[model samples]
Target: MTRIASCQCGQLSLTVEGEPALVSACNCTRCQKRSGSAFALSSRWNSNQVRDRSGKGLTYSRKGASGGNVLFEFCPVCGSTVSTSLELLPDVIGIPVGCFADPAFPAPKVAAWCESKLEWVRFPDGLLLLRDQTQPMDTR
Candidate 1:
């Protein structure tokens, strides 16, 4: 199967093939600001799975919870983050689940940075909740 994730204005997009390696949610302050929500849901895919990427995007680099630099690419026109890459996981690409806008998209199997999660936030049963981002991303 293949999936396409696009920015709000559809100016930036990525075409990915096959299923993602993992799906997770993060409640770090950076994620909250990035998604404008209580937390951010993202899917991890092997860089090779990205068949195509289109449109121009601005890039931002930040220190992630794991103490590695994470580069984010966002649509300049819509100001929506399209994708991200972590220095610690060079061969992986991260895409926000919301970009797909699919109601049937897979739910996050892990929730990280629970220490920063909002007081009222709750995850579904069976979701592995971690207080920090030190755990391996592929621990599913």
Candidate 2:
């Protein structure tokens, strides 16, 4: 199933397919700086499922300290960070859950980069927490 999503200004849009691979929150410094919030929600989906509308979305790419490039997709009109893609995670694209338009959507299943998690930040029940992206899932 394909779902159409757009930036706040609607200037940029794209279609993503199916349920996300992983829905999770990130508390890393980069995520916090990018989102300007306590944490950011991401829905990971296959990159092949994404189709662009305006064909003019802006991208901000940077080399990750962990290696590979991180690309952030956004709308030039509203300056919204809409979707993201990484070289390491080739098959998946991360979409901000906040952009889903439907507020009734489910929460994330994983809390990524928990090592950077703030001392006072809280996580949802039954969600997996990761100190780094490579960490193993902790059932506890």
Q: List RMSD in Å for every model shown.
A: 3.2, 2.1
Report the lDDT tens digits of candidate 2 across residue range 1-140: 66767788777777776777788888878889899898888888877777655546789998874789999989887899888889888888888887778676667878878878788988867787887876844645
Give per-model TM-scores: 0.94, 0.87
The TM-score that candidate 2 achieves is 0.87
How many clashes show up per model?
0, 0
lDDT of all predictions: 0.91, 0.80
Pairing residues by index, what is the TM-score of model 1? 0.94
For model 1, which pairs clash? none
Q: For model 2, what is the error of residue 115's alpha carbon versus the real structure, in angstroms, after optimal superposition? A: 1.9
